[model samples]
Target: MTIQQSYKITPIANLLGRSGSSHLLLGLLTVAPTGTLAISDLTGSIALDLQHAKPHVGKDAAWFCPGMIVLIDGVYEEDHNATTSGLGQTGGIGGTIGGKFIGFSIGGPPCERRNVTVGVSDGVKSENGDVTAGAGFGWVDFLGVGSERATGSKLRRTEQRLLGPDGAHTGTAKMVVCGEVNLDSPSTLEALHKMLRSYATDDADRMPMTVVLMGNFVTHAVMAGGNSGSGGSIEYKEYFNALASVLTEYPALLRRTTLVLVPGDKDPWASAFSAGASAVVPKKGVPDIFTSRVKRAFAEANREAGVKKSGVEGEAVFATNPARISLFGPAHEIVLFRDDISSRLRRTAIRFATLSHDLEQGEPVEADATMMSGGLGTDSSTRENTMDVDTPTPAPAAFPSAESADFETLMARKLVRTVLDQSHLSPFPLSTRPVHWDYASALQLYPLPTTLVLADAEAPAFAVTYEGCHVMNPGRLVREGRGNQIGWLEYDVVSKRGVVKEDML
Candidate 1:
């Protein structure tokens, strides 16, 4: 969102007397007990009139939910003609401030790129026209990949040496991401076997650096029969045993690539307890007890290769539902989350009336593709591998060819904007999308990462770039109507590109 000029924020309390005067206010939007839209701040709460309000960004660019804190520009009107006390007149403490705030424009705060927030960006411009340098947490190592100031330069040099024009084009910088790997499904297992075998055929140097397998892992909830004595636990363990057999057949792939296992809502423990219901995030990974056989397979492979069983050559990682993977120090940060966020957003979103014709005079925001391609005015290479720079290479064939106004494109934009602007994974109310309070910080997207793998089976398989952050959803492993073909995404770290690929069974 672009700022035309500086505006001072007016407290809700100050609006008590200043009727008919325009003021900018920052507050959390909420639904009052009366079922009317209201904005609340520590100062007070005020009813809002947004019947004709236009979002500073485009109308359909974002999903407006009640829990979001936003900037609202409008005028205040007093309720002098009312018969009874409007809000704070004769009511108790924490009563509503007088009258309705007439909103003209509203939008969430602009998101900061990871580079700019870490003081590593090459002089990116802020809304105030000042160079944002040495701002934010430049000293912290959120991902344990050395502090930005200490190891940033060294890792950048290494990145250039490996991915630049003069560098080697080894496929080590690429990552393979596959989602919804239901272990009990024979078709899913066949697809997984084919994909791994195909990757195993790659020459040693060209092997993918990391292969991420997101899970439902079973057709139904694990431990659904209840208790350890029930058949649910036994069935769940057998699935892993079957997976171990698959891994044992491809020891070379196991020895060469890091396999990251991220659990989905239907995975064990949580799934067992939730009884096929939506579980709170960020959920714990599949329990170690159920994955012992898979670990043994990796150990056996490492031993056969004559390498330290625990060395970095290759191994399986059981990661939390929402996890971060950092490579090349602070250069690349990829967040992996498995959930049905799109459906949830649609279900809980606040439906705004269609944008009025008079409001059409407002400036239209650029499309996501345009905004992603240098809209932020930062050169790509200097901004920690953002796709801002124009490359001669063609976009992957599977990249969506639909126009900006396409329904899928619009939904993708709305989802991306809502998530990125809020800087939170699940932006709905806690009741709608429960978050683990203690680990809530793990779900923040602040200093937005370079890539986001949101394994949402309900949403279409899409790769969308917005505000320099690339979000991709591989969807389910098998497309129902597409001849049972398997689909997944291949993300290239150096090029900052992701392509969806499908293979026939």
Candidate 2:
């Protein structure tokens, strides 16, 4: 008759008591193919001794694959100050038996283990007992190093530094997560889970959090090394999937977490080749073993959460909330996404535009034209030939009959005298005095809607005849003149005539 045997599994708490005085043993009786042993505190600290414990079988005696004995210890305190020593006892085997023997040590005053041994036995008295010891201790420092007084003093100093005499608040927080996560190890996962839980509970109100994630996250498949070569690894999709699974499992802790990914120089894509030979590279076929994966993971998460993403070039800004959020790449370039301040700028621009438009539409304003006629006076023989025949005759000549013969003769003689007096001015016949006065009378002021006048003379000295108005010299002061200047004369607007003041003449 053939029969099948079954074995009973036991929790480590059932074998070990709550205090630090118990011997927890497994694989000593009714050995099976494989099994696990754990010891934990239900309320307080629990410790055990396993110096005399032995595996069920001898070296080279294999029922199937090898089996192992696991030990776990749990404690709680304000600070870590416990010691774990000689917890694991592997007998006469090199590799893992009953799967790998795992030791879980959690919580307490930070503990340190010493004089632990591990490896294979070679049938000598001392050497045979020297198989690899799989035992290690892990603990948390409940209360940190500094005293309460010291902490308060540091906090006060920091506040004083950040907020000066004006008492303005300015503070920033920076968080750094260095090193890699071992996804394959269950024990490592459990330890990480506990650490994250503690962090979430302790630091929840911290704002403007700056997180810098560094180092190689994904491990190479064949080489199993850090920052080695690229390629020959699972694609990023699979990697992201695994990461998503882990994150989803811990949603309560990571729901509002903001992560920034910075790629290391030794990342996989940064390398030229993987093996000693040249191989064609595959796209999306190998996982990115760098910080790019972290960014991609965040992007996917944001998308799944229905966050809006928008940007230009390779840079992007995400508005997961009303708060402004911007993400950049590669660390070499910095991109800033901010609110528009153009509304303030538009006011100034509008003022300038209005001035320009008014200037363009209005008629041109005229300036005073000061004529310095060099060829104004000469002898009649020299002057008549130079003067154009079509030019208007002088007013004195045209109204010669109005003056008596004696007066005309006297004026002609006086004009001849004035011509000879100012002869040194220019050789041109028109520059003569009598001829100059003739040309000056025929001059007409151009009509303009607006005109500006600036003059050093005291007053205008001539009469202006235009448009049926015989405008007489009004003897007005040029300094307070309202009308524009017509040549050397200051023309009055109301009087419509160029007048010379007594002082100027």
Best by lDDT: 1
| Candidate 1 residue-wise lDDT at 443 | 91
What is candidate 2's TM-score against the reference? 0.22
Model 2 / residue 443 / CA error / Å: 82
**How many steric clashes between backbone atoms does each model show?**
0, 31
Cα lDDT of model 1 overall? 0.74
lDDT of 1 at 141: 84
Worst 10 residues of 2 by lDDT: 330-339
**What is the lDDT of every predicted structure here?**
0.74, 0.25
Instruction: Please write out the lDDT profile of model 1 over residues 321-398, one tens digit for every residue.
Output: 899998788878899999888777667666544344444667543322111211222233343222221111234422
User: Model 2, 1-505: lDDT tens per residue?
Assistant: 0111222333332332223322222321112223322222222122222222222111111111111112222221111122322221221122111112121121111101111111111122223444333332112111232222234245435545643333332222222121233233333234334434433543333222332222223333223243443333454334444544554443323434554332221223432343211111111112334234434545555455453332111111121100111111110111111111111111211010111122666754321111111122223344332221111223222212213335423322222211111211111122111123432311111111011111112222233221112222122222134432212222322221233323221
